[model samples]
Target: MTNQIYPCLWFDGQAQAAAKFYCSIFKNSKITADNQMVVTFELNGKKFMGLNGGPHFKFNEAVSFVVDCDTQEEIDNYWSKLTADGGSEGTCGWLKDKFGVSWQIVPTVLPKLLSNPDKAQNVMQAYMKMKKFDIRELENA
Candidate 1:
C-alpha cells in the first residue's frame, strides 16, 4: 500500500462551488468528483478535498496556500483575482478568498532576496508593508 497525504478543506455548504472556483483559477485544474457533501479536485496536479460540513468550522490564517509567482504580473494577477468579490487583503502577500480561504501570493525570488545578509532587512521591511509581493521591489531591496 502507498500513503498519500492531501489537504481537506471544510466549507459551509459550498464544497462544489469552491472546487469549481479553484479550478477556474489555476491553469491546469479540474474537479475530479463532486456530490452533495464532498468535492474532490486537483489544482495544478495536487489533490484537494472540500467538504460541505456546514458552518461548524471555518478557515483561518493558521493554514494558507502559497503560490510562488516568477513575475510581478503573475503576483498581481493572482492577488487581484483572489482578492476579488468578498475577499480581503492582508499584510505581506496574504489574502482571504471569497470563501475565506487564506492564500499567499509570493514572488519566486523572495527566498533568494531575503537570504542575502546585506539586504535582508531592506527586503523584509519592503515586504512587510505590502499586500501583494512585487518582485522588482524585492530585488531592489
Candidate 2:
C-alpha cells in the first residue's frame, strides 16, 4: 500500500473562488470537485483541497508553497499573478496571494548558486534586494 499526502488550505468562504483563481494561473490545472464547504483542485497535477473553514484561522509565513522556476519568465509569471488583486509582496521572493496564502517564487538555480561558498554571499546579497527572482542576475552573481 502507498500513502498519498496533500495539502488542504483553509479559506474564509472563498474555496471556489480561490480554486478557480489558482487553476487559471497554472497550466494543466483544474478544479476536480467543488461544494459549498470544500473545493478540490489540481495544480500542475498536484492535488490540493481548499476548505471554506471560516475565519478561525488564517494563512501566515510560517508555511508557504515554493515554486521553483527554471527561467526568469517563469518566476515573473508566478510573482505577478500571485501578487495580483489584494496580494502583497514580501522580501526575498516571498509573496502573499490574494487569498493571503504565502508563496515563494524562486529560480531553480538558486540552490546551485548558493551551494558555492565563494559566490553564495554575493548571490544572497543580490537576491536580498529583489522582490521577484532574476535568474540572469543570480547567474551573474
Candidate 3:
C-alpha cells in the first residue's frame, strides 16, 4: 500500500449520502465500501473516505476539490449534481454542496487561458462577471 493520504471528509451522519451523491456525478465512480461510521468512494478515479462523525465539524472553503473539465457540458453536469439539495452557488464556478464541501467546477481551458499572457486579462474579465464559468466566453475573451 502506498503512503499517500486520501482525503477523509467529515460529515454529520451523512457519509453514505455524500458518497452516493459523489458517485452519481462522475463516470467510472462508485462506492467501494460502507459501514455505520464510514463510506469509501471513488470520484473520477480519485479515492476518498467520508465519515459520519455526528455533526461535530463541517466542511469549509479552506480546502476544496477542483474538477478540471474538458467541456462546458461536463462542467455543467458536475455543477448541477454537486449543487443539488441545499447546496449554495458561489462566484467563479465555485460551489458548496449540501454537506458544505467546496468544489470548483472549472473548465480545462481555464488554466490555459490564465497562463496565456496575451489573453489572460480578457479571460479574467470574463470570469469576473460570471457565476458558473462559460468556457466559450473564456475562449473568446
Candidate 4:
C-alpha cells in the first residue's frame, strides 16, 4: 500500500465548474463526484476535490498545478482551455483561471533543458520569448 495526499481545492461556489473545465482539458479525466457544494475529479490520474466552501478564501499562486506536456499542441490546447473566460496569462506559461486558480502549463522538455548546464541559458531565452510554451522553439534554442 502507498500513502498519498491529494489536493482539495476550496472554491467560492464554482467547484462543479472547475471540475468540468479540468475534465474537458485532460484525457482520461472525469468527475467522480458531484453535489451542491463539492465536486471531485481526476486529471492525469491525480485526484482532486473542489469544495464550494463559500467566498471565505481565494486561490493564489502559493499553490499551483504544473502540467507537463510533451508537445506544443498539447501545451496550446491546455493553455487555451484553462485561460478561457476571465482567466489571465502570466509570464513563463503561468496563468490564473477565472476562479483564480494558478496553473503552469509547461513542456516536458523544459526540465531537461533547465537541468542541463549547457542549455540552461538557451532554454531560459526560449521561455522568455513565449507567453505560452513551444517545445520546438525550446528545442531549437
- On TM-score, the stronger of 1 and 3 is 1
Task: State the C-alpha lDDT per candidate.
Answer: 0.91, 0.94, 0.91, 0.89
Whose lDDT is greatest here?
Answer: 2
Q: Note the residue pairs that clash in candidate 1.
A: none
Query: Model 3: per-residue lDDT, tens digit, 45-104?
Result: 889999888877878899999998999999888888889999999999999988899999
In model 3, which runs have C-alpha deviations exceeding 4 angstroms? none
Q: By TM-score, highest first, what's the ranking? A: 1, 2, 3, 4
Clashing pairs in 2: none
Off by over 4 Å in 1: none
In candidate 4, the residue pairs with backbone N, CA or C atoms under 3 Å apart (3 or more residues apart, or in different chains) clash, namely none
Pick the winner on lDDT between candidates 3 and 4.
3
lDDT of 1 at 123: 97
- Residue pairs in candidate 3 whose N, alpha carbon or C atoms collide under 3 angstroms: none
lDDT of 4 by residue, 70-100 (tens): 8888889889988999999998999998889
Worst 10 residues of 3 by lDDT: 51-60
| Model 2 regions more than 4 Å off | none
| Every model's TM-score | 0.97, 0.95, 0.94, 0.90
Q: In model 2, what is the error at residue 86, expressed in angstroms?
A: 1.2
- The superposed Cα distance between candidate 4 and the true structure at residue 56, in angstroms, equals 1.1
Task: List model 2 lDDT by residue over 24-141, tens digit each.
Answer: 9999899999889999999999999999999999999999999989988899899999999999999899999999999999888999999999999999999999888888988898
Scored against the true structure, residue 16 in model 2 reaches a CA lDDT of 97
Model 2, C-alpha of 105: deviation from truth (Å): 0.3
